[model samples]
Target: MSSPPDPEDLTARARIRDAAMRHFGEHGFEKATIRGIAETAGVSSGLVRHHFGSKEALHAACDEYVLRTVRKLNEETWAAIKEGDLAKASATRRPSGRYHRYVARSLIDGGASELFDEMVGMSEAWFTGFVKGDGEPDVPVRDRAAVVTAWGLAIPILFEHLSRAFGVDLSTPEGDIRLASALLDIYSHPMMSPEEAAAARAGLERAARRSTTEGTST
Candidate 1:
């Protein structure tokens, strides 16, 4: 009789998933070949096909794995926030800048661009649902918008920080966190008026223009 799958087999599978994730992150979906992944995982290419079926299935699994990690991190952050552990919450929050870098790199490295869009759409849907809660006990639209905005700003900042921790180039997490905190402070100011918002918009526009000019020149 054939032996049952051993713990070593499970560990090997997990290693394959990790190798796939790193390869995909570095080279992207389209360019990340199954043979390369198998090589990285120290397994036969045939084994990879046997486990994941196809490149598309492997891509889906990778996306699902990343999203799952993000969701778990977010949950941990929320729990810390609820428990009034600000430091722990900050540490546990998903790094937004890192995520943005990952997406940008994936696009540049010929990764599956469609997968990126799908991930973002999924995130938006999840965020909307979380903000809306039960429609039966409807929240004020303004309050919901505020919550959504806060979350939107926070997530990217967390990604930035994680990217730095992981040694990825692009914006540092500390910088993103500082910027996000400033924005949050401005938004939460007791005396924040329309004038302040207008000024902030103007400043943001100037920054964008400067960045565009620099990019063009380079």
Candidate 2:
């Protein structure tokens, strides 16, 4: 009988998946090839087929992996938040490495609706539970969460534009510093005072009411 596949060979499945995600993230499905993925993973194309059967199946597996990862992270974040350990929650959201590349790719490639919807639901729950826990959101929590999710997803899609605007490649250390500094400034220094923000929200509520009254009349 043929000797069992080497122990190293048994671990090829995860390597292939990681390599496929990298390829699919950098290049779309049509551009990424099984041979290229196998080469990156240091495995055989036959092994890729043996594990996932086909490119589409590999892609589906990647989606499942991403979904599972996000769900786990969100759960950890939620638990941290409940315990008032915001630092832990923040850390939970900051995953290390190129894994997130596939998240951006999945958003762009379509057919990740389950993943997207799951994120939206988690975002809605977060906004409802914490962001506006003491008061009403300017918009409904679900709508607000959806918009926030869109904005978060837009980062990868708009990465090039942001890099150009910042005049630095976002993949570099300097770019990370610059971007983090900018975000810090934006979050720390509110553009509007409490009164101004309250007034704006009130105005929005008034406009919403007016629109509702007009619709009722019609």
Question: How many clashes in each candidate?
Answer: 13, 0
lDDT of 1 by residue, 100-161 (tens): 54444555556644544444554454455543332342344455455554455344435556
Model 2 lDDT at residue 13: 91
Q: List the residue pairs that clash in candidate 2.
A: none
Span of ten consecutive residues with least summed lDDT in model 2 = 1-10
> How do all models score by TM-score?
0.53, 0.71
Whole-model lDDT values for every prediction: 0.61, 0.78
lDDT of 2 by residue, 15-130 (tens): 89989999998998889999999999999999999999999999999888778778877888788878887556555655522565777777777857987788899898877666
Off by over 4 Å in 2: 1-10, 159-218
